[model samples]
Target chain A: MATEIVLISLLKILVVVLTILTCVVFLVYIERRVSAFVQNRVGPNRTGPYGLLQTVADVVKLLMKEDIVPRNAYKAIHDLAPIISIGVALSTFAVIPIGDTIELFGRQIKLIIADVNVGILYILAITSLGVYGITLAGWSSNNKYSLLGGLRSSAQLISYELSMGLSIVGVLMVSGTLQLDKIVQHQTTYLFGWLPAWNMFLQPIGFITFVTAAFAETNRLPFDLPEAEPELVGGYHTEYTGLKFGLFFLAEYANMITASAVITTLFLGGWHLPYVEYVGLSSFILSLVYVGTFCVKVAAVMMFFIIIRWTLPRFRYDQLMNLGWKLMLPITIINVLLTGIVLLILH
Target chain B: MGSNGKIIRKKDLNFWQRMYIPEIAKGLRLTITQMFKPKVTYQYPDEKFVPPPSFRGRPVLVEEQGVERCVACGLCSRVCPALAIEVQASETELEKERYPIKFEINMVRCIFCGFCEEVCPEEAIVMSNEYELVFTSQEEAIFGKEKLLTPIEKLRPRLEWLKNNR
Candidate 1:
């Protein structure tokens, strides 16, 4: 069992890291494509056959590009910030179950790095650490724009984090377990033996709040006041260059992938296909199918992220805060209370 | 409000409108339809997009055994619509007339018109539809002789055709 656990853990880490990289590369491609389609333009069509190799070429270029550190900047922290951000981003994936375990080479392997009893909490805490990089990078740069962006991101993250945590608290309460795999298992059975087991139906309010919070956390559009280019210029990494700049971008997409994974795990019933029983399919085939199903769900959420980004205008920083604290928070709290009462009576 | 001076508005709620259920069902129905419908995207690697008949793409330089067919003629440079093409000439190993020694196209400047093809008597520089030109920097977009030549020109029969004809 220990050997199996060790192998599973290794596999999880490998999958998470690779997926993070692959998803970031494709997410950029997809975002460009979606944005192009929206604006009625043909996006990236060159690189490796249909421009699929564009990201790979970009990575090579970035790696080969000159590394320039500003003379006035705090060299140590400026260098360390991106590392911290990427570290935090990668760490959050440890708690997420992409899909359930299946027989592999005659051994069962779980799809999570660590199925900690407090997995949800662990993910939340780890993700929160990502802000440190932005703050440190901003402070180190000594640029006014970077400093202002860093401060805005900090305040924005802090405000939204509260409501985001609260929304998930209801989910944790309902599931009664922190282990993501177990939460998913609990959600596998239908609510009325007909309705599919997913939190989207049960906790609509929480789902909305959580999705909104994710948009805020990712520093994406509408909530993207931090990098409001017209106002704040290039945001926290305005002065960053070469691999350092690449790392910031890397962390952003990694966090995005993590957010999508978290959404899948929490609200979308990670890897659980509606109206389809996993009991009948062969274990190996079932795992593959589940992984495919999980990817489709993540892709939909990613597309939704892109679509909303294109559709919505950037919210004023104040408006963003008001929506988070005044509107979303109040509605979510009432939802939690009402949901709690209903669950209690049902129980 | 109905009896008092203040006016009260009556709201109508249909079964579907009363809840978000109808909207969600509609969304699901649309997604289902799209899933079954032919994917609009051209899967470029395995299944390339079938270019339209007049699709503008790769630059074709006619060759006799991998050597360019221009015979040092400067007509293409004169006829280039955007004035973006540059060709330098030098005597080939054949010890006959000079051919292009350095050939390049400034893709950033080139309007992608088939002007060069129309101007060429040698049937050189026809634009094929195999365009996948993605680059992060401006420098990468500039094409040299190596990149300007299509992969088809390197194939055995075409190379053979050029050599035998020459």
Candidate 2:
């Protein structure tokens, strides 16, 4: 029984990791194509059917490049930074429930890799650690531009992390739990017998603040001051080449996927297809449908991320700080208070 | 509006604009609509861009009825800012009397300035529409009379353009 449990856990980890890696590869391709479309120009379509294998080609090319280390650089720390970045970005997926518990091999299994009671806390903690990677990379590279980028990123994360956490506090108050699966399960219930009790509806201000903060956390455009090419010249990864640079690139998209999945699991209904339970589908088919629904929700959120990146210009440094501290922070605090009051009254 | 000229401050934006969400929505709508619109990419290699007669390309000597129009005046060589043209005058049995025995233009030195064409009194040398110039070696870049002579029919558009423009 113990062996079986170990094997199941291993299988789940393997599946989750592989899925996240593949998603990162495709996300890069989709981002390029979508950005091209937004600008009224055709993107790379020549590299294997609408540039589907473009990211794959890019990875192979990155692998072949020479690993250059500056003479004045802290060699060990520089090497370790991308690994830290990639590890933190990928590990945040462990607590996100893609689908509900399902029967497999005559045994019940939860879809989440790690069923930690404090799932939301784990995600918040892991994502915050992502800044260390950029900061260390900047300091270790011994480059002025890289140092500035690293400093900006750390500041940005600090400013935004508060609002991000507070926004989630609003969701937590409504859901009454920290476990991601439980939060999703709470959202599965109907409000007023017709409206789905997704946190997006229950705490609209929290949803907006959370999404904005997620964009900042992911270091995407508008909040992508870390790698602002015009000023920073590839930012913290300025001195990075070959596979180390590739790892940082992969970590970014992986972070985007993690953010999207978390948003789906929290604010959106995780794997719940509204009114699907009444259709009377078989258990196995129902589970499959639920997984599909989860995937679709995540994809939609990711598409929103990509479109917003192209649509919005990067925030000036002062503007970013003002928005984060002055605007988002207060708004999220208010959202948390409002959510607590509503929950208290309803109960 | 006072001393600031036409500069619009953030405070000047009325409520909805200051909120930024509604303004962002408008921007998103514009971008999303642009996504479905026709792309403006020209697939090169598969699709070539043909230059018009007005375009100044590589200079060529006009060949008329199995003979060059050049009277070996050496004007184009003297006028060439790049000193690319080399004319060695020699007597010919043709009606022009004087012909270039060793007429050569070092493309390595040629700047495509069209000065040689502009100064040619006989209108013998003119800029053609052929711009694809590639050479592996310095020797290959030096065009002798054999390589420089282009038939009058092929030079018609350029010759006509020069006639009208001049």
Candidate 3:
């Protein structure tokens, strides 16, 4: 029985990692296509049939390129930086529950990789560690531009993480659980019988704060001060070459996917479709439906991320700092207080 | 905040503008609308761009029937700012009295400036609509007479364009 459990768990891990890596590659392809559409240009249509194999070609190119390590750089940490970045990015998805449990071969299998009780906190802690990869890469590169990028990334984290934490606290207060699966279960209840009780509807301010903070945390546009190409010239990963650079690139998209999944799970009701229970499907079919629903929701969120990247101009460094510290921080704190007060009055 | 010579004050912004959320929404709306708009990309090589007569692509030597119109006057070499054109004159039995023994255009140095075409006395060199030039080596980029000469029929549009526009 124990061996069977171990085998299933191992299978689950393999599936999750492969799915995330594949998604990362395709997400980059999607991002490029979306950006092209926005800019009124054709993007990457030559690789293979509407550029389906562009990411594969890109991977092959990156693999074949020369891996140059600077003579003045710290060799060990420079090599370790991308590994740390990608490791943290991929590992954060372990707690995300894609769907409810399934009964197969007369035994139940939970969909999540590791069902940690402190799922939200675990996510926060792991995401915070991602900054160290950038910081260490910058410091070890022995390049001034890289160092500046690393410093900006750390500062951005410090300013925005507080708001991000506070925003999630509102969701936690409403759901009354730290386990992510329970939070999703809490969100399954409907309001007025037609409208699903997603956390975004209840705590709109927290949703906005969390999403914006997620964008900053992912080092995406408007908050991508760390790798501001015009100013910092590829930033912390400037000195990295070949697959090392590819790893940083992969880690970024992976982080974006994780953020999208978390947002869907938290605010959008993970696998629970609106009025899905009314279908009255069997357990196995229902689980499949739930997984499909989760994927669709995550895809929608991912599209939003890509759209926003092409839409807005990068925020000035001071503006970024001000938005994080002055605006988002206070607004999220107030939102938490409001949730607390409402909860106290109700119960 | 108004220390710069521009003298823009931060206090001028109202509460909504200062909040920035509404502005961001407006930007998002603009971009999303743009995504639905028709793209202007020309898939080059698959669908070649047929440039107008006024367009100056690579300069070519005009071949009329079985002979080139070039008298090898060397004026193009003198007029070329980039010094891209080189012509060697030799005695010829043709009516022009002198024909180019060797004509080479270092395309790497050629800026597509149309000066060579403008300076040619015999109407031999004119800008053709052949813009796609690919070379794997520096030597391959240097066009000899075999590469530089194009049949007048293939270059009618550009010649007609040069006639009307110039």
Model 2 Cα lDDT, one tens digit per residue, A1-347: 89988899899999999999999999999999999999998897888988899989999999999999989999999999999999999999999998988998888898989899999999999999999999999999999999999999999999999999999998888887999999999998999999999989988888888999999999998899999999999999999999999999999999999999999999998999999999999998899899999999999999999999878999999999999999999998887777778778978
> Tens digits of per-residue lDDT for model 1 on A1-347?
78867766787788779877888998888787666666555567777777787888888888998988878999999999999999998889888777778787787777668879888889888878888999889889989999999899899999888888989977877888778889898788897778887888888889988988999998988788778899988899999988999999899888888898899999998988876664687778888888888889988888777777765678997788888888878978887898889889989
Candidate 1: list runs displaced more than 4 Å: A1-4, B1-166
lDDT of 2 by residue, B1-166 (tens): 5586876556677899999999999989998999999988878778777789988889999999999999999999998989999999999887779999989999999999998889888999999888888999999999999999999999898889888999
Model 3 chain A: which ten-residue window has the lowest total lDDT? A270-279
Among all windows of 10 consecutive residues in model 3 chain B, the one with the lowest summed lDDT is B1-10
lDDT string for model 1 (B39-136, tens) is 35554586777565366665666555556566657787899878878989887677546778888888777787877876777766666665777778
Best by TM-score: 2
- Deviation of model 3 at A347, angstroms: 2.7
DockQ, per model, reads 0.04, 0.80, 0.80
**Looking at candidate 1, what is the lDDT of residue A225?**
78
TM-score versus the correct structure, for each prediction: 0.69, 0.94, 0.93
Q: What is the interface RMSD of each candidate, in Å?
A: 6.9, 0.7, 0.9
